[model samples]
Target: MKKLLITGLLALCLLTQNLLSQTAWAEDANDSVPLKTVTLSEWEAVLKSHQGEIVVVDFWATWCISCLERFPHMVTMSERYQSKKVRFISMLLEDPEEPEAIALAHQFLNKQFLNKQLKGKNGLAFDHYSMNENLMKSFEVLDLLGIPAVFIYNKGQLTHRLTGDNPNKQFTDKDIEEAILALLKSS
Candidate 1:
């Protein structure tokens, strides 16, 4: 009977240790990265704040496979244009009301090393924002109807709107790069 109790106690201890370790691992994964929630008005204010600078805003979501696939290219563009006056911003379109969605977004960002890459290490500062679902739906000013959209703004003016709405006329990363190059040359 004493041996049975000891064996049970050992098993309990092992289970407790395993649970604690898993919790710690989860916390460590997300500890350094945080998703900032923003309303539509706040998003407008962010754009207004960066008036004179060229802003490249990539609208993406965790569920969009194309967005995820194209994200690395945006990061590469951000790194390549680090010496310029362009600002790369990633706007995550997720339901802020859902905690799980927000957590998943953070996990994705961390996995992509987005937090580290966009930390303003060298030249241009990068911004990451998670838009509320209602705000995202109401954002008609951009006339955005799809994911994998990139809006390029120069001197507070919308210069380019790249979207994959049309099946045949989809935009590519090279197109985005060319737009930025043209803008840079003009400035």
Candidate 2:
């Protein structure tokens, strides 16, 4: 009985060690993912750089209930439509003055990537931004008056904007997919 108990404990130790190793590796991978910080001028430059491509920008905030609800769907859409012509960017509408908000946004992104919710060939290619009021105004997201807004730009021109009247309304992956398909078909 003593020998059997020892063997079982040894097995458990090995299993625990393996689990720790796996968890460490996942954390390391997530740590390596770069989340960029861009000012309004930098953001405009990025937009200009991708002039010929279809850009989908999601305007969100960590505290926004509607944004949180729609984030998973946006992740899935980014993964599903990974393409050279189509690019996905997430603009976190957090005040740049608040460091806590930026840190929270990074944490949320890390979790999303670690869980494979944001997986694709272009998943890591997704650019993240913490936009100030100026940036928000430049993108016209402030006028929309809500989080979880999505805008599609074709060849540097604003093509479509999806903003909901009610914050409780959740936008589905299919809704974004349909918009992307229509845009692609047009070009």
Candidate 3:
């Protein structure tokens, strides 16, 4: 009985050590994933830099339930349209004053990337940006009342703006995919 008790305790200690190492590795991996905070002007500059290419800008927040639900579809879309040169950009809308919100966004993104949601057939396929201004002000500047908004651009021109402003006009992943296909066909 004494030998058995000692073996059990040793096994428990080894298990705890392994778990701690895995947690540390996950934290380090999350920290390495770059999440850039950009102002509206800086975001515009990013769009301009990608001029002449099809761009899909997804605006979401870590706290938004609908946004989280639709994020996986966005990842799939990014992979689908990657070969067509469609740039997928995820803009995380969070209060810059709230460090915890920023941290949560990082955690959310880390999980997505680590789970292979953000990876394409080739590799990583999305650009991530966090809003660097007040949440309400950022929404106002973007002319949006609420999020889970996706803006599709073609040749640097605003093409389709998908939002959930009205109950009757809410969009789905299929709608976004159709819009992207239309833009690609037109180009």
Candidate 4:
């Protein structure tokens, strides 16, 4: 009986340590790097890094026209509310190794996106960040429905999503601002 209790105690201690270590490991992996969100790889830790804060994640593609149109507002909001509780991230949905496509991506981002919010991975890690077409579809973020297809995550739950490229039709920065404020207050 004495030996059993000792063994159980040791097991419990080990379990607790393991849980703690797992939590720390996750955290370190997420906050390992920081910058304006741009690439899919950058978003690998996004959901993790933005814990306790509001995260608006935009899954876009260079070929996406709607994404281009709405890119400016996203970048502006990211910079404007940067000091606040919200963090905005942009991830490309296309493959990076395709030199021609990537070049086009860069040009589109520079000219149309205006390089505002966050561009990540520097090159491409679309698959690494699980932003592939299938993955996006799994997350319900796929389909050529729109650009700047933004999802607002509050406390880890998707609170709102805007799935369109037409700025004239989708939510504006003002709308985003209001949503973030309200969500943060309620949370």
TM-score top scorer: 3
Q: Which tens-of-lDDT digit does each residue in 1-187 have in candidate 1?
A: 9999999999999999999999999978555444567878888898999999999999988888999999878877888887896898899887667879778877777766644555533443566788875645645755788888999999999999899889998999999999999999999
The RMSD (Cα, Å) of candidate 3 is: 5.5
Residue pairs whose backbone atoms clash in candidate 1: none
Q: What is the TM-score of each candidate against the true structure?
A: 0.78, 0.71, 0.80, 0.54
lDDT on C-alpha atoms for all candidate structures: 0.82, 0.75, 0.86, 0.59
What's the C-alpha lDDT at position 82 in model 4?
62
Tens digits of per-residue lDDT, candidate 2, 61-125, equal 88888787877677777777775457888888877778798788877877776656344334454
TM-score of 1: 0.78
- Give the higher-lDDT candidate: 3 or 4: 3
Off by over 4 Å in 2: 1-32, 115-123, 132-142, 165-172
Each candidate's clash count: 0, 0, 0, 9
Model 1 segments more than 4 A misplaced: 1-31, 114-117, 120-124, 139-141
lDDT of 3 by residue, 99-184 (tens): 89889988887777665645433345688899998888899999999989999888888899999998999999988999989988
lDDT for model 1, please: 0.82
Per-residue error for 104 in candidate 2, Å, reads 1.0
| Cα lDDT for residue 132, candidate 3 | 96
TM-score, candidate number 2: 0.71
Report how far off residue 43 is in candidate 3 (Å).
0.8
